[model samples]
Target: MNNYNLNHLKELESEAIYVLREVASQFQNPAILFSGGKDSIILTHLALKAFYPAKIPFPLVHIDTGHNFPETIKFRDDIVDRLGARLIVGSVQNTINDGKVREESGRDASRNALQTVTLLDAIEENKIDCAIGGARRDEEKSRAKERFFSHRDEFGQWNPKHQRAELWNLFNGRMNSGEHFRAFPISNWTEMDVWQYILSEGIDVPSLYIAHNREVVWRNNTWLPYSDLIKLRPEEEIVEKLVRFRTLGDITITGAIESGADSLTKVVVEVASSRQTERGNRSDDKRSETSMEDRKRLGYF
Candidate 1:
């Protein structure tokens, strides 16, 4: 007797594809919350594979914080153009201008938390009943509380205890009017799984993930890229270093780590042995132990 079974990566891929198809079948309007990061890129790739021979049914929606790395924006546009996919961008700056939110001020200032309002507004404006994302439970404690299909109330609030139960690959997307769902196809994947799959599948990620020389400064225990949003104290000097980001977000809040893993194989190997979670470098999450959970309650992806 010959035994045939899917490998570990294939199992994760199958689960993600199943979740994507379920989102399509369960919701009237759906979208992918693309951030030009590796996770979102992988989500888009899996979505493409899920409905091959036909264009992805839903559009890609990005909540632009107006503080992104230039390389990220370029990569986002190039991939969208290549896929001929519809792109909708909700600007945080615009939201700030409209008095919907205020930009944080001071030396530790960042617009990272402000993304919640913009994301919520975007959801309502687009009438998106379900927003598909690439968040993984292994990323953080708050994220660990997430279900495959997370429901948001009419005001876009998430109550973890009140979320519907998911069992045996069965998802319940039932919700009242004015409510929506946040579907995570890759909810169970870990950082290691993502990198290994990316390597195996030959998926292209932004150049920021590869080690390269860039101007950075030490801040909040990590190397932060020099950008207009940051204020350098007199003692802080901008120095060049070979670094790579494990996660991508607004340049103001996202931090990079010194690394020599310039290739995908090296990245996967590095990830396998690393002790810190990828988001450990992010300054926003350091604000509080529950910072991510707090943001989630306010509709931040």
Candidate 2:
């Protein structure tokens, strides 16, 4: 090892920047999946730093489940406007109307699973061969098996067992026609790494991550954000609670935790000693032991 001081966060940033550039050089049409989440915000920040004088070469693709938080959508639009990056939205509701995927039924109904169809459709419609996502290995068990350059079949399905070997920083993005890649620049970064980077870089994330008073309902062992999309069960009455979301997604499925960490400093402390995974509140993953894997196989990011 070199005798110089080692800064892990800076090292991670450098690696992510290198991966972003690699995607730019390798793919014909590449886009970043931006959701105004902390991870994607970091991706955007790095992309800005990577190619400073030039505008971001790729567009930002958002797959609208139609259940997104109002704050998230507003932040997304604001960032795209500020950065002058092109935005592409693929609507799950449109996919449903087109008879591609149907909405779920019963009390456990959610549009979370239907997002895969919209994502695949968006990739096909936009002719995007490479999609840069803000997926971290520490976020989920299934994601822990991902590569920096993850391969997808012609149908956009992922076979986790059959991944390309990224040895010594040499990434192989070779794919046949109709095939594409899901490249994760920060796959190696942990939750703490992201928090530290955000704090250090002073990046802005959506307001949901910070603790605030919101009307929520207790469901499926977690606090569900109150929204028009969430049908209030007779017994499930909405109550005001001070909560924050660990992960952001469809209002019906994404779960929130009771927190008092209002600032970034408090958030760092909260994340440091947290016993559960960052995605522990995501009810979509609670469907089964291999739910994430199953979704990934079906082309869910």
- Candidate closest to the true structure, highest TM-score: 1
Q: Candidate 1 overall Cα lDDT vs. reference?
A: 0.93
Per-residue accuracy of model 2 over 53-112 as CA lDDT, tens digit each: 899899999999888899999999999999999999999999999998888999888999
Residue 34 of model 1: what lDDT?
95
Residue 127: error of model 2 in Å?
0.7
**Residue runs of model 2 more than 4 Å from their true location after superposition:** 1-3
Which candidate leads in lDDT?
1
Poorest 10 consecutive residues by lDDT, candidate 1: 158-167
Q: lDDT tens string, model 1, 1-301?
A: 6788899999999999999999999999999999999999999999999999899999999999999999999999999998999999999999999998888888898899888899999999999999999999999999998999999999899997777878899999998999999999999899999999999999999989999999999988999999887789988999999999999988988999999999999999889888888999998999988989988998888
- What TM-score would every model get versus the actual structure? 0.99, 0.97
Question: With candidate 2 superimposed using the best TM-score fit, by how many Å does residue 135's alpha carbon deviate from the native?
Answer: 0.7
Q: What local distance difference test score does each model get? A: 0.93, 0.91
